[model samples]
Target: MKKIGVFTSGGDSPGMNACIRAVVRACIYHGLEVYGIKYGYDGMIKGEIIKMQSHSVSNIVQRGGTILKSARSTEFRTKEGRQKAYDQLKKHGIEGLVAIGGDGTFTGAKIFSEEFDIPVIGCPGTIDNDIYGTDFTIGFDTAVNTALESIDKIRDTAASHDRIFFVEVMGRDSGYIAIQCGIGGGAEIVMVPETETTIADVIKKLDTGLRKTKTSSIVVVAEGDEEGNAAEVMAKVKAENPKNEYKVTTLGHIQRGGNPTATDRILGSRCGIAAVEGLMAGQRNCMAGVMNDQIVYTPFDDCISKSKPINQDYLKMMNILSI
Candidate 1:
């Protein structure tokens, strides 16, 4: 393939610009023309692509979010829309492709490439860190660190007021952030979606702390936790005891912003270069990820369809440490 294109889709995450920069510079270093497709698949279908030079990605490594931007495309779900996107790529003389984003991005890349016979590779870029194959997604370290900083600050207020703070962290369907921040922030309890957790269980954990004469506590709750958001869980617990003060702080998109941490910058950059190399190696329909400090490739099907399970041992260790 003489030319290739790259884009970021779905939600914006920290370190994405790092990935974009690496892809562009790697392409130039390898003597292949590269184009940046703005707004992801939506941009591709709309023909919103532009040639990218080495300078196009200069000084963007520390930036959060993708320089190419991101958007969801319902139109790309249709064959007609895919056709238009294919025609647009062909118009630009693009051959192989690099996709950046989470499962939605991989699903689209998998389908588009298979249907059009275009070689495509992916780089995981979600802050949620839900995708399988990779130990951590591109923005996870930065996001977790962001939430941990908030939890640390909240702990100060909780101790002062003798209050229980229920801190909600981002991670749509995964508990990676909550579990990590919970342990790192020294939370009394953590509620995640991966394992069944009831409001009663949380109350029990809090009660255990209370019996120990603890004045204040932090409870980390994943946004997707089945027991509900931090606020909802706090309400249930408050109704049960009706004596303790409680507050809920949802980190929301703050975790998705800010400059990526050193770890994320490295991971994103590594995956970005690996993606270009994978495409050049004629490896199609896969994602490039770093595991155990080594780059590994996983098929898009596994990245999307396979379950990425959280380590229960980590949860157990957190519980042991909390009490």
Candidate 2:
């Protein structure tokens, strides 16, 4: 391909700028021209395409969020909108594409490639870490670490006041962040969407801790938990035990900001380079992911159709260690 396009869609996450930097440099290193598609598919239809040079991406590897920016385009889901996007690509002489984002981004790329006979490679860039192909998606480490740091600070106050704290972390449909951060933060209890959780179970755990004279306790709840959000869960727990002081802290967009961790930077860089190499190798409609410390390509259908299950062993460990 003489010229290729790259863009980030869906929610923004840390390490995306690093990925964009890697894609620009890798394409340039291979003597290929790169075009930046601002605001993802929406921009593609609007013809918001710009030429990218190595200098355009300089000093962006350490930045948070995406330099190209991102947006969800309802128009892109329709046949006419996709045709406009494809025409825009033809106008810019873009032969291949590199898409960065979560499941929705890949789904759109998969359909567009098949319809237009274009080669497209995907990079998992969501903080949710729910993609099936990779062990961990880009920005997951940074987000988990961010939540863990906040939980640590909350613990300090919980101990001082001798109270119970309900800390909520983001993970729309997955418990990867809540499970990992709960264990890392030494939480007394953790509620995830993958498993059923009840307020009675929470009160029981707290009652046991109180009997042992535990000065403080923390329960980490995933936002998508079956029982409800952190606030709803806290309300139920408080109703049962009116005498105990309770507080709720939701780590909302904070987890999606800040500089990426070393692991995330490395992962994003590797995936970005692999995406360009995959397109050059005549591979299309696939995602570049790191598995077992090696780069691997997975079909977009498999990556999005299947669900990535959380490790039950970690849940078992959490139970054993909490006691």
TM-score (all chains, Cα) for each model: 0.98, 0.99
Error of 2 at 166 (Å): 0.6
Pick the lDDT winner.
2
| Model 1 per-residue lDDT tens digits across residues 174-215 | 999999998899998888889888888888888889999999
**Alpha-carbon runs more than 4 Å astray in model 2:** none
| Model 2 per-residue lDDT tens digits across residues 1-323 | 89989999998888898898899999999999999999999999999999999899988888888889899899999999999999999999999999999999999999999999999999999999999899999999999999999999999999999989999999879999999998899999999999887889999999999999998999999999988989999999988888899999999999999999988899999999999999999999999999999999999999989999899999998998888
TM-score of 2: 0.99
- The worst-scoring run of ten residues by lDDT in candidate 1 lies at 197-206
What are the lDDT figures for the candidates, one per model?
0.92, 0.94
